[model samples]
Target chain A: MTAQPRIVEVRQKVLRRNDVLAGELRDRFREAGVYVVSLVSSPGSGKTAFLEKILTMMGRQARIAALVGDLATDNDAVRLARAGVPVRQIVTGTVCHLDAVMVQSALEGWKLAELDYLFIENVGNLVCPSSYDLGENLRVVLMSVTEGEDKPLKYPTIFNGADIAVVTKIDIAAAVEFDWNAARANIQAVRPEMEIFRVSARSGEGLTEWLASVESRRAAKNRPG
Target chain B: MHELSIALSILEGAAEEVERQGGGRVYAIHLKLGSLSGVAKDALIFSYKLASEGTPFEESRLVIDEVPVVVFCPECRAERRLSSIQQFCCAVCGTPTPDVVRGRELEIAGLEMDV
Candidate 1:
């Protein structure tokens, strides 16, 4: 005789392991006094350029490091090393995104307390990265002028998950006819009141303001509740 | 694209739950997938089938309950169901609010098993 199948109650998160690990990472970052920032975007959105600019500009005053995620190559890490800070490349192989476990393992020998700022450049895919949290104080989603104004609307999930939106390659905005107002509107439509930064990493436009905003945000993170 | 990974995680979670229940053959898995969870339901279903091969859940059915995005509208002082995931505003008062109260759930609600 076959027994009847019964319904079992199991209210559990599928990503609970990742969430727990991320929570631990968040606590560790807090104790170590390092401001962690993560960048996410579709491929060729100028994330590497923007991050390289930030690292190069802030390297003099801050103890900085970066963990860059890519499918196969260390090319980005090689390029970013020009800034002269400690940089590590996380080769994800077939994986599309970086989870907390990857980030934890990547920081094996590094001392988080010695660093003032740590940047994680996620794999250049908007969809998968939105599902995982890397314990970062800020998650910046970048969209280049060449990607069109409707990028946010098309990938609303990633934009909605991010804390800030950055418009990259503004120096060539006119060549691409990128509608700033339309892009901002689309982003606001999805995220509502999200802080945005317009930047040109090549020409150094808006770098000062962006840097100031980041510093202030980091300072605010250090404030005790 | 990462649905395969998500499918594997679901299998892992279900297996643990089954083990905790003294071992059972799961026939169905109930999942709550949110609009903002960044996972597509159809892709996940397909991936689940591929991931479940040779496992106890090989023949299991994944029943997904898609949860719509809901945000807290401060202007109306109420939780409102968003009409569209693209626009995060109160359906009633049209107040724009970033305070999302629900709709990011990717959880296993229940499992049907033969113990």
Candidate 2:
């Protein structure tokens, strides 16, 4: 037998499989004209409440749906479904974060082609979610003002992974002694070019601008190059 | 934690590679972990053992290379290795770097085997 070095210079990424699946999902989302917005944040950072408001607000303009992920409990799904949109709960069964496989499975049996907007609420953790690609067109990482300004510094990876950083609960920023400027600076320190959105899901402050940003991005992608 | 999910993916990737190679059991998986990979090595070590249970990768060793985060100082036009992952400031110039030339990766770069 000829000696052929079985060692192949693959140069393939470790998450190559997930990347492939995510690409396919992206194509599916593009073809269906569905704009997917994924939310990720640490526990109790108001990710659920934020999505609830989003679903409630966007309920008038278009058809919307959501998939919520958690290690346990279907509470968020219940809350979001109150907006009169179809919501699916993905109980991760002990996994700390949702991966591409979980996202792909959640898409099954659903007519993605029919939906206008799809939102995925990730498990309440910053670290793990950063590593997984959940096939989303937009990944919005939320940080409530109640959290520390050093949040982006400590959890740099999660902040860096996000396309946009949403500072939530601005209504209580001062009451909670939250330093808004420092938080923005901290995020910029970690990811210099990341978009910033100061939103109060409860007060509806900054929601219109946030929604407009999402719409413009969707419109931009739909535009021919 | 998320380490379990990452460990699962690592095992799956290694298994697929091993199967395609005809015959060999994975003895160990080598991962080049950059300082900015966001993975705490100690935590991954603990999670890897737990994730490998009842799977083809059971009993396989995990070898990790601690790669230092290196960046190019745009101001000074010099490449420097970060003293720590948390410390992104250039050592010599003390300038904030614009691009991440190396570091911040979660990759299964290589694998050891028994054919």
Candidate 3:
């Protein structure tokens, strides 16, 4: 009896192509001098609220644009546009995450050269968004004070990919008895050196510092080497 | 919840692969899904059946190799597979936070088909 011949040595990455496209898009964003930032958080974590306030504060100085994704509805974009910033809505029919392809599609008619800051608010899904890259310079993961502090531990992948963490709705922290210390501890446990901002979009607290940080980062990127 | 979409993508990719490698019916698909991938194996299995309906992979079975989360213990200077993402620390030495060495993968290894 002849032994059956077996062939091996097929090394393939299913998502390697997507990662390549994401790298290309990152290069495009950098070359255009656009500070691309993406936001990821759970449902109703006040992403829109925080973004609206930030956009309003960043008017004139920065030509800011936003792309908000949801499972349905253009409500977030509509709400965000009232702040006098160019905001677009991406309705991902049945998708759970915003991948690189979606970001590429979202920038179809967008003039990247005209914008200083471009914020892409991913679909409100902690689990799905972490697996996909949207070609952003920074991925900001937001966690509201009302949510359990253990969210960082529950969704460590999201936290780990994030460049910074924004603790939203801090004004109501005491009302909800939110463990700010535990929240900080959880985030620090997962990402030791991640920059964190405790901001209240409603009360306008910590807005200056957050705005300053954004400006500093953008300025540092534009520095002559 | 997004398992159906992932399953559909898997079937679509596998079908294309099989068609490119001559005409053959897919028998099975091997997947490596880590514990920290945020994808439930059972959910993907349940969705695979629905997604494969009327597709080239209609009769294929999904065999998943679940990988545990592995972390590097700075204290012990060793890598260990973690039981859970919540407790991603050293098994011994009571280390608080360690770097995640592995286990956040969700990939389709390959497809098996009758040539």
Q: Compare the candidates by TM-score and give the number of the best one.
A: 1
RMSD of each: 0.9, 3.4, 2.7
True contacts kept of each: 0.93, 0.21, 0.15
Give the residue spans of candidate 3 off by over 4 A.
A1-11, A219-225, B74-77, B92-98
Higher-TM-score candidate of 1 and 3: 1
- Chain A TM-score of model 1 versus the true structure? 0.98
lDDT of 1 by residue, A90-114 (tens): 9999999999999999999999999
Which digits, one per residue and each the tens of the lDDT, describe model 2 over residues A129-206?
877787899999999998889899898778866889999999998899998888887887777667899999889999
> After aligning candidate 2 to the native by TM-score, how far in Å is the CA of A103 from where it should be?
1.7
Q: Give DockQ for candidates 1 onward, in order.
A: 0.89, 0.32, 0.30
True contacts kept of 3: 0.15
Q: Which stretches of candidate 2 lie above 4 Å from their native place?
A: A1-12, B25-27, B53-59, B70-98
Show the colliding residue pairs in model 3: none
Q: In candidate 1, what are the lDDT values of residues B1-115, reduced to their tens digit?
A: 9999999999999999999999978889999999999999999999999999988899999999999888999988988999988888899988888888888999999999988
| Candidate order (lDDT) | 1, 2, 3
Error of 3 at A10 (Å): 4.9
